[model samples]
Target: MRKTRAVLVSAAVVLGATLTIGATPAHAETLAGVFREHSECERVGTRGTDQGWWDDYSCEWEGRYRYYFLYA
Candidate 1:
């Protein structure tokens, strides 16, 4: 009975792990460097989206640069 319980628990754990991993959402890729101007950042982002390099992008001005986050 103990062995059966252990097997059931192990199977449950494996199944749970598989489901969790499979259910994970896709993560986006980001720009490697920061942009000095918002216009520059938006320009690159727009080009990327228009040319099919990325699905979409959003620019955020933070600190000294405009950070471009790209999503596939």
Candidate 2:
């Protein structure tokens, strides 16, 4: 009876650990420190920064919030 109880307790502990590890969520990827293409429409600038492909031209605009990535 003691041996059976020990085996049951060990199984419960292993199962609990496995479930806890598997229940965690995975991390997500972010877009930072990458080249992008910029374009200005009206007074708002739109940019596409995915991977390292920059093919864009900018025109003069007023009261626009523009963002760009810098490499050092």
Cα lDDT of model 1 by residue, 1-72, tens digit: 999999999999999999998884566456634576677778877888889887867776575433543333
**What does candidate 2 score in Cα RMSD to the true structure?**
10.3
TM for every model, in the order presented, reads 0.64, 0.37
- The lDDT of each candidate is 0.71, 0.45
Q: What TM-score would candidate 2 get against the native?
A: 0.37
Compute the lDDT of residue 34 as modeled in candidate 2.
26
Query: Between which residue pairs do clashes occur in model 1?
Result: none
Q: Which residues of candidate 2, in runs, are more than 4 Å off?
A: 26-72
Error of 1 at 49 (Å): 0.9
Clashing residue pairs in all predictions, respectively, total 0, 0
Task: List residue ranges in candidate 1 displaced over 4 A.
Answer: 21-23, 26-33, 64-72
Clashing pairs in 2: none
